[model samples]
Target: MEVKVPKEIRDYQESIFFGLSTRQFICSLLAVGVAVGLYFGLRPLIGSEEVGWMCILGAAPFAACGFFKYHGMTAEQAAWAWFKSEFLYPKKLVFKSDSLYFDAMKDAIAEGEKPPRKRKNHKPQPPTGKER
Candidate 1:
């Protein structure tokens, strides 16, 4: 018998039921519960067809949480990161470097003194007749 193995050991998740991990199974159960609740609660007020659509919409987020993964982060982690980036820290961070050389030369530059041109230390000279 050939046993399946994941390329990355960390990616391996033991299937608890119906080929779903424990977390996935739990989320699926929660989604089903929400869908059933929505269907029964809304069916009386709205028609069966409308309530069915509402159940799907209501349960989708719960189901997505189990399946969704981004950049190795779970849905909840990604959601929290997004919330922090958008609400808690919304300002754009720009990097500004402080150059001591530039700061020292600013006065001369403003006074219109052109910086000295860089020169190569080693210049090619005519080859000597003597060979090594």
Candidate 2:
């Protein structure tokens, strides 16, 4: 089935620069900025090339984070969505012990109340004598 996505979502997914969307392009720029900043800041304490390389390596994952997608969502969007789902307004959850105990208690109560109900697919028993 073809799912109809909103125009806004489609627009957000469109590539504006090379293969990167505006958000992704901006994120890449920010990552480069952070790498440069780290290189410069740490050059005095460490060696220039070593620190620069380390900074680039470290910033690579953060930069690439915006380049992928999940469930038709951009990587950044997916990550943020996951964060929200995990921490903010989570769904109701039951503990294993509670669920097991509740299920057993429910079964006990149901057993005490009644026997099995006849199903629609149940066939009537055939008579052995006159009634067939």
lDDT of 1 at 50: 94
Off by over 4 Å in 1: 89-92, 108-114, 119-132
In the range 1-132, model 1's lDDT, one tens digit per residue, is 999889999999999899999889999999999999999899889898999899999999999999999999999999999999999989988988699988988999999998887987898888898978
Best-performing candidate as measured by lDDT: 1
- Give each model's clash number: 0, 0
Reference-based TM-score, model 2? 0.51
Instruction: Please give the TM-score that candidate 1 achieves against the real structure.
Output: 0.77
Query: Tens-digit lDDT track for model 2 on 13-53?
Result: 67788988787888898888889888888888998778978
Local accuracy by lDDT, each model: 0.93, 0.79
The root-mean-square deviation over C-alpha atoms between each candidate and the true structure, in angstroms, is 3.5, 8.1
Clashing pairs in 2: none
